[model samples]
Target: MTKLSLNRRHLLKAAAIGSVALASPAYLRRAHASGGEVNIWTYNNFVPESFKKQFEADTGIKVNVRLVDDQGKQFNLLAAEQPNPTVDIMTVAGHRFLQFIDSDLLAPLDTGRLKNWGNINPTFSESDWSTIKGNKWGAPILSGMEVLSYNTDYVSAEEARTWDTLFSEKYANQTAYIIQDMMSIIMLKMGYDGNMVAYLDKPEEAARIVEEAKQFLIKHKPLVRKYYDGGAEIQQMFVNQDIVLGHSWNGPAAALINDGFPLDMTIPKEGSYGFVYTYNIAKNAPNADNAYIFLDAILSSPEIGAAMTKASGYISTYKDASNHLTDLEKKSTSFTDEELASLQFFRAEANKMKYGLIDPAVEAIKAA
Candidate 1:
């Protein structure tokens, strides 16, 4: 795979620049002759600089991107903007779209307007997350998952194949994971059938499973060197040899492997969680025509999809995006058909209970 030089610092710097751009009123007012500007709210590095410049050059639609890392913060900002939102486009996770839909913050996507809509992989576009109640609400763009990542120099492929490796006595004090993710995966490991959402309506059962996971985490707390926060922190831990085994997002793990680190990640035998990130038009977008133009430009081109995958270390939902990837990049980021079949995607309708149960359980585990 071609090594991408971007690290967390570079991403943060980009986000800082985007934030400054969003804060400037004059920047938002600038218009082009061919098409008006499209204001987007998305994660840093989700839309690479190269793609943005090329899109602008091709369409004459100036792209104004505002970066927000936290999904909760993004939702609140969009909600606060009300019926007249400054953002024309925004990125949201598949499982989290229901709340936005419930609040009527998203506009129904008219797929007929997007000629390249067929380029999207059915795994995403056909899923319940995007096609809600017979209406298309978002365009699936990229996907990411939590996986067991380990340094190959110190950990064997055999050991990395299961979630149990994280708690092995031999690797104690050399393991790390983000708390909430670890807890959720633990619930999966405990025979929830990879369907935690099934318990959302059954509050008593949900609480029981969450409590069990919380206890398990508390027992294993001593094995973990740290409950890291972001992708960058886990990547740094691997680089410094502070962790031999970690629960990490596939994106960060892929970045380390591509950069020549002796690291590998796997979807453990017990299974893992996956979430799709999507692009959606904000309700009442001022430049709706420009928004559709921007979406078409990205969806139709495999080159843009490949660039997005490389820039973010996430899998592109564009079906042909892989054609542009290096063999090594494909191996690191793209999943095999069997692997894809085995994944349990997060459910959109269950966020309320999922977080209500998992969040407090995680806090209690941390306190323990």
Candidate 2:
């Protein structure tokens, strides 16, 4: 297991934080073919190790987690393997949820059985991601937002608030932004925000908007140290002083800040980009019955939901969970009503064809 997959801190915390008083399962739900091991596919960094163990202890089933090396690659792989899916539980971003439904790759989710179903926040739990194909591809647990993160030892929040600071000569070689999922976000500065209801629905128009973002970023590149895909690498760079300011997610930034490293999650003037890492069940999964158990454990149990977010970086979308998180999780976790109100997430489906498909425009921006 990778460092990310094996995280035990949150589970240790969950046990202490959550009142584990529920009656033990009266009887394991009758499995379709008898419950066995469940397979989970997601990136290594975010899956909490504690979640897997506690869940296993409760249900007497094993979770075989597969690491998804790249987001884009994983999406295509699932789309192609629709009929003969391998993994049982998939933790994917919301935008990708729409794609999964489009490909007819999933089974309808029955959240009614989940114990934690009532704990999830309405914003994250709503039927938004439950698509037209009738399969609710993902059940969102946490919402993540990206903002300009800066090392407070060197830069000030006020200084990093505007886009101009990145373009300024002073911060040159000291700034960075994300590449894969933030084109529409940057376009917000150009007055072309991601109203997926409008922009994502029109690919050509989204492409034009992306072009403008490229123009801004290409010039901003000289001032930037690098472009990033969300991971430990960005935080490593910040800690080492390789870059002073970055476009990064809430968890890492907050983690660094709470660890006493000089870090700040700067909310830029134009707003921020957002996404939710949600739980989905794979069709033809090897252990889907167990998968359902795992999903319910997370969605319905406030204790599990809260502890899951405490361990993982993203904010838990469950509204009813008890929070036993560290001060950092309390401060930065995005799932709460207060945090949601403060956030400005981008719309899904709108810029998807243009940004979601990795068309020429997105590649051009990356290559540039």
Candidate 3:
């Protein structure tokens, strides 16, 4: 088979067989704070950790930040908890907001206390995935996009944008695939309509698109060194000359180049996938007022927000803060100015298929 065809098959097989595919975790009991605490569930290095410091300094609400294992699992866990939850707020993808809200795990929000709510960029305030129903249920702070990156030592930026070259038949098994659960984005990049994935994911039309992409990945599977789960590992692999070009988050891609790795990102002339995280209040939050205060306190300060932006490699939702970013970072902020104007956020009703798609893809690979 041609290398590209093999790569497609491998990708499908990996998605079908991979085990990182997470199912929504169920909650058996209500976990609540014992005192004047606002427990938060967020990623290890995102806003929660940085904001926690400022929040405690300002709100005196005694912030308790918990690192959840991962986004998919976190959502499943919250879904299980339902009426009673362990967290006051959980940082998850904005697209998944309604899934949680509809499950009744989130509480209605009051932005009145959030003086800086106006600072949020209009895109997020009404982005394709603002899932609070009629009222705002989640607060958006920072966002980034998936971009193509290449090791300058091996390839040029111009050449990195070509998925065809990256998954050539000659280098099929020598390639690497990302293990993050964003196969939809990959499929989208392969000439399929991701924007219409909501209607397409289950339709026979999508089958042609998916099968085409699947053939591409599986054909290249034998060439892949191994699938990577985190951006850090992916960066390391590139730095070590393990791969020439790959798909990765813009932050780490830029960081590698900023930190002096022979790396650079490809600003797809055609655009790329965009994504964001939202802060959702748990239904049974013990410190609702404090959470609101903390949300406002952190998001309002453009300086602090910009600092978080620099540290996290995401574009701040606050336009004022984004303007303050260095010209270089602004051009490279989770996106090229061109990409920000072009790429669409990866949005489809995040449902069981959203999570199920991962394992099924991995299973498909194993079967192959």
lDDT of candidate 3 over 217-281, digit per residue (tens): 66667666667666556756665566777777776666455444566776566566777877878
Q: Between candidates 1 and 3, which one is better according to TM-score? A: 1
For model 3 the TM-score comes to: 0.78
Error of 2 at 225 (Å): 1.5
TM-score of 2: 0.82
Sort the candidates on TM-score, descending order: 1, 2, 3
Backbone Cα, N, C clashes tallied per candidate: 0, 14, 46
**Per-model TM-score on C-alpha atoms:** 0.85, 0.82, 0.78
Highest TM-score scorer: 1
lDDT, candidate 3, equals 0.62
Compared with the true structure, all predictions reach lDDT values of 0.80, 0.64, 0.62
Candidate 1: tens digits of C-alpha lDDT, residues 70-126: 687799898999899999999998888888998999999999998888989998898
| Greater-TM-score candidate between 2 and 3 | 2
Segments of candidate 2 deviating more than 4 angstroms: 1-35, 127-135, 199-204, 334-343, 356-358
